[model samples]
Structures are given as C-alpha cells and as structure tokens.
Target: KKKVMADTNVFLDRLLNYDKENMKESTVEKMQPYIKDKNFRPEQVKQVSSALVGLCQWVIAIEKFYRVNKVVKPKKETLGIADAEFNAAMADLNVKKAELKAVDDRLALLQQTLDESNTKKQNLEDEFSNTEKKLTRATKLMAGLGGEKSRYTMQSESLGEVYSRILGDVVLSAGMIAYLGPFTSNYRQELTEGWQSLCKKDNIPGSERYVMANFMGDPVK
Candidate 1:
C-alpha cells in the first residue's frame, strides 16, 4: 500500500510538470484545467474521481511490469547458473564413462591372457600325459623282452667258442675231403684214425675224439 501511494504521488508530479509543447494541443487543453488548479470543484468531482481511478490503474500496471521484470531478471541469472552446473555435470559423467570403458578394456585383456594361459596349461598337461603313456608302453615292452636276454647271451658265447676253433676245424676238413673220397670205407676209416692219432699227438684242437663219418655227414656210416 505504501509503495502504491508513493507511485501515485510520483505519477501526479509528472502529470503537473508534463511538457505542453510536446503534447497534442487538444490533450493539453483537456488536462490544462486540472493541472493548473490541482483542486476539483463540486461540478468536476466525478471527473476527478475518474482521473484518480485511471491514475491508480496506471500505477498498478507499471508496478506489475517492474515486479515481473524483477522476478524475471533473477530467474534468468539462476537459469544461467543452472545451465553451467548442468554442463559441468555432463562433463563429469563423460569422464566417468571413459574411465569405465578403460576399465572394461583392461578387464577384457586380462581375461584373454588368462584364457591363453589356460590353453597353454592344457596343452602342457596333454603332452605330459602322452609322454607318460609312451614311457609306460616302452617299459612294458622292455620287460616283455627281458626273458630272451639270457638265451641270446648263451648263444653269443657258444658262437664265440665256435669261432675260436674255426681254423683247426677248417684244416682237418680240408685234409679229409682231399684224401677220403676215393678210398674204401675200411681204408678211409684206418687212414682217418691214423690222422686223428697224429693230430692228437701234436695237441691239435678238435682232434681228441674226431669221427670221420660224422665230420663227413655220411649217413651210411
């Protein structure tokens, strides 16, 4: 109410001091009586009341315009602050998203490495298993062949003994073949016995109990 009264007084002072030269002539003439007198006569009481009502309406309209502007001005500033805060929040959110993506990428790399390591471990295990199986089979095969070793060893030793006597056997065989083919059985036997006796006397190898029939492979004897 006080503010309304102040605005009313200011409006009245402006009306009293209004420049008549700038105003229209008809408008100045119509307002000149009220502006000069500042007091309403009994006959002009209704007009004065009407003018006061118009002045109050104008004051109210002006006050409302100023009040609306006051409210809008601060709201505009608040809106600017709010827009800046929103932009900053969005920037923070984008940074967080980038960080999350980096973390996800790192996690994927680690998972891939772990998978590769697992594959290598599996391959090593398979190789070890296969090698172990081969070793087991080889051990079994060697064990199975163990029984023949002694017989082979004895055969080797017998062959070595036969090899040592080969020279003496060859000499006796050659002589018998050259001399015995043309003789009668009794003569051949007699000659072979004499040759055997001579060989034993000289301590020749394989001559101690030599048999002509056996050496010659003669089935008739």
Candidate 2:
C-alpha cells in the first residue's frame, strides 16, 4: 500500500509539471481574442501586452491551484460523486475488518475450549483404564485365594478323618489293656497272637504289624 501511494505521488508530480508548462502558452493564446486593438503606441502596446501576460499567468495559476486542491464545482459533479463513493467503500472495508477480527476471536475461544475438553477426556480415559487394570488384578487375587481355601478345606477333611480313626483305635486299645491285668503276661501274649491272627485274616502287611503292636502297648498305656 505504501509503494502504491509513493508511485501515485510521483505520477502526480510529473503531471503537475507538464500542466504548468502548457498553462502559460495556452492562457496567452486564449487572451489574444480579446486584444483586437492594433492602433496602440509601441510603449503602451508593450505595457498592455505585459499586463495581459501577467493576467494570463494569474489565471493559469488559479486553475492549477483549483485542480491541485480538487475544488468541486457544480459543472464537475462527478468529482463529488467519486469522493462520496470512495468514502463509502472505505467505511465498508472498516466494517468488514471488524467482523473478521470478531470471527477470529470466536474461533480462538472455541479452539481453547475444545483443547480443554480433550484433555479432560484423556484424563477420564486414563482413570478408567487404571480402574479396569486394578479390578482385573483384584479378580485374579480373589480367584487365587479361593483356590487355596478350597485346597485347605479338602486337606482338613482328610486330616480329620485320619484323626478320628486314630482316636477310635486308641480308645479300643485302652479298653482292652484295662480289661487285661498288668500281672497277666501270659494273657497279653495270647492277646497279641490273636491280633496277629486277625491281621493275617484281614490281609495286613508285615511292615504295618508293628503299628498294631505299638497301638496296643504304648498308646494304650
């Protein structure tokens, strides 16, 4: 825009110089029509010619000044119309610039809001993912603990059955020992022989035979 203004000023300067050069010659030619008297003395003619020349110069100067200042007359209404239209165009451009600035501001605000929303959404997604992972870990832990509990219950039931059998055997052996007198070694031997015969009938192993002997003697006592 500045370059255009500089170029326009240069052109106007050249045009004004051209017009000034032509104005003096054209003005003198136009004034010659009014000067029809050829009877004047040499001195008077020179003086009147000089005066007419001055008047012509003044007229050209006034015209140049009027052109330079862009004085609008009734005969040249186009100048006024052109000036009005240029002013209207400039006003419209200002309004358009203001509207464009407002739109830019609105866009900036919306973009900021969108960015904040995205950040919140990302945080929520991260939190949900973390919660999901924690829940999965807890589920696995519970499942593992349940397996351990089930195994313990089964083991306890098996142990309880074995203890019940051992307790019954001990009680039966205690009754037998109490019935058989301590002084009757012969009768105790006979009882051992009878238990051995019963073991053989039941198909008991020789390695387990001492278990019955220990139960009858040590456990009973």
Candidate 3:
C-alpha cells in the first residue's frame, strides 16, 4: 500500500511537471521508463497499464477534437461564401426589379400617347368626312341651278337694251298720240304700223309687235 501510494504521488507529480504543449509526447516519455523496466513489481505494472490506458483515451479525445475542428472550419468558410453570394444575388434582383418598373412606366406613357394620337386621328377623319359632304352638296346645288342662271343672264341683257331705248320709245308714243287723235281707226293703225317699222329700222327699243289699238283703246268698248 505504501508503494502504491508512492507510485500514485510520483505519477501526479510527473503529470504536473510535464510540458502542457506536447502533453502526449511528455506523458509517453515519462511512462516509457516504467514499461521497459521488466523488473517492476505487479503493482507497478498495474499502475503503468492504467496510466497507458488513460493516455490512450486522452490522445483519442484530442484527435477527435482536432478532426471535428478541421471539418467544421471548411464548412464555416463555405457557409460564409454562400452567404455573400446570396446577398449579391438579392441586390441584383432588386436592380432588375427597378428596371422592370421603369419599363412599365415608359410603356404606360407610350400607351397614353398612342391613345391620344388615335383620338386626334379619329377627330380629323370625322372633320374631313363632314367637309366632303358639304362640298358634295354645294356641287349638286350648282349643277341643279345651271339652266336658271343662264335664263337670268339673258333677262339681264334684255333689260339693259330696253333701258338704252326707253327715252326714244316714250317720245315717239307721245307724238303719235297727239297727231293721230282726229284720224279714223284704220288710218291710225296704218300710220302707227309705218312708224313702228321705221323705228325698228332705226334700232329703237319698243314692243316687238306693236299695235296702236291695243295701247290707247278703252276697256269699256
């Protein structure tokens, strides 16, 4: 029991004094002496065996920790890269959305312009149709009045000729009335016809077929 106690105290002392940075190597170096010493007693062998088992367990635990960290570090780096990529993608999507909104606004403006133009075009077409209809009606009216216009022109020319001869005709009729009052009806008619023939030869204006009886005869007779 005393030897076991001594061995345990020596083991604890060695554990405390060993290099912490290279724990596995220092612990193995310290235990190597006991393993190779074949002259050790049963208790010493048992203690050494127990220490080796514990050392193996520590080494395994440390190795597992290192392996887990190695794998987790790369995974963390990959996750960071993926996060950055996701943020970039989201930013690009936002830009594209803004562009699409601008396009939609432009399209709406263009549509408004097109609608206004169409409305203007329709109004112009309607105005043209009305103008064409008015022109057609005017043309037809002019065509229908063609003969009446010609007749009015002839009447106007005849009145102008009569105006030129009005004074001469009035004097001749007055002279005949004063000179022929004492004559018989037959003599009056003959004299009036002769005067009318002479007036026509002189280009005087009067009735085309003049008769003295028709002008001065009484309605009661």
Candidate 4:
C-alpha cells in the first residue's frame, strides 16, 4: 500500500515537471526529447517498479491464502487448476510402479517359502510311509502270522527298534521352515526351547507355540 502511494506521488510529480522545465528555445533545442520526458525520471521509474513489485507480492499472498485457508477450494477436477492436478497424478502413477514392484517381490518370496515348505512336507510323508512299511514287515516276522500286528501289543525287542525309529525320525510339515524330530523324544523340547528364545526376542507370546510346534514337528500321537 505504501509502495502504491509512492508510485502515485512520483507519477503526479512527472505531470508537474513538464510545465516547470519548459525552457528557452535554445535550451529546448539542446535537450533530447527522451531527457525531457515525464516518464524517464529515475525516481519515477523506482516508484512504478515498487508499485508493480507490491502488486505482485499482494497477488502471491492472495494465491497462497486461497491455497491454505481455502475460502473457496476447488474440486479434484477444478476448472482452472486441471493442469497442476494432472501433473501431480502422473507423478503418483510413476511412483506407484515401484511400490507395486516391491509388493511383487514380497509375494514372490512368500511363494518360494511356501513351495520349499511343501517339498519338505512331502519328504516327511515319504519317511513316514517308509517307517510304516518297515513296521509292517517287523510285525509279520515277529508274529509268524503273515499278517499285520498291533504295534502296541507286540512289544518285542527287535520291533521296539522300529518303534524307536518311528519316534526319532526327522520330519517336516506345513507352514514352517525348521525340521523337527520324533514324537516320543526330546527333539520337540529342543525345538521349543530354541523357538522360545526366538519368540522372546521378538516379543511374541507362547500360546502361538502349540500351532507353531505342530506345524514344525511331526504329530505326537
């Protein structure tokens, strides 16, 4: 506002100078028309420059106030600001590709983990099948009956070896990376202790162990 006053005052002085400086013909002939002009004064130029600068500053402040305080906020697709919003949308789209690629990497890693877990589970199943085959043969040889026998009732020393193998065989199962040992041995206890240490570090509770254990170890019964 002060700058506007200064500029107005200078412009008024310019109009006044034309009347005062009208000189003799010899002096007027010696003077350049450019030098005689009301608009050419240095003070007049500064005043106009200041007023323009002030006007620009005021316009910028109004624009910023409209942006922040929002006396009237435009929509996503506003009339005059579409170019600005379009550029922002394109920038977001450019960023989204990298974000989606990171998600894809995580999904790929999870899929590989799942596949490895399944393969290990299949190997455990094969081990179980082999153990069952051996137990069947031992039962037939011990009973001398050419038929399957109850594992619990037979209790012979040689067949007990097969029972111990069944109890101690390393096995794998679904949804876990670590392998575990048999049902009747301390392998499960070892695994539990190790996992407890890990879970404690991670601040997870022990109740999840039942599910995690069954997933990591062979069945108990």
Instruction: Tell me the TM-score of each prediction against the true structure.
Output: 0.53, 0.44, 0.47, 0.29
In model 4, which range of ten residues has the least summed lDDT? 167-176
Write model 1 residue lDDT over 21-56, tens digit each, in one string.
344446545654654553533335546686565654
For each of the candidates, give the backbone clash count.
0, 0, 0, 0
lDDT of 3 by residue, 1-221 (tens): 55744787786676456444333545545655654566443454457686455545544444445557566868888999999999999999999999999999999999999999999999999999999999999999998889879998999998787667665456567867789889997887788778777888887777665544444457779
* Model 4, span 99-120: residue lDDT tens: 9999999999999999999999
lDDT of each: 0.70, 0.64, 0.71, 0.56
Q: lDDT of candidate 1? A: 0.70
**Deviation (Å) of 123 in candidate 2:** 1.5
Better of 1 and 3 by lDDT: 3
Residue 10 lDDT in candidate 4: 82
List model 2 lDDT by residue over 1-221, tens digit each. Answer: 45743686685565456554334546556645544335333445457686445444544455555555454444357767888998999999999999999999999999999999999999999999999999999999999999999999999997676564564455435545677566576776577556656655665433223244654456656
Error of 1 at 133 (Å): 3.2
Which stretches of candidate 4 lie above 4 Å from their native place? 1-81, 145-221
Root mean square deviation (Cα) for candidate 3: 13.1
In candidate 4, residue 72 scores what lDDT? 41
Candidate 2: clashing pairs of residues? none
Better of 1 and 2 by lDDT: 1
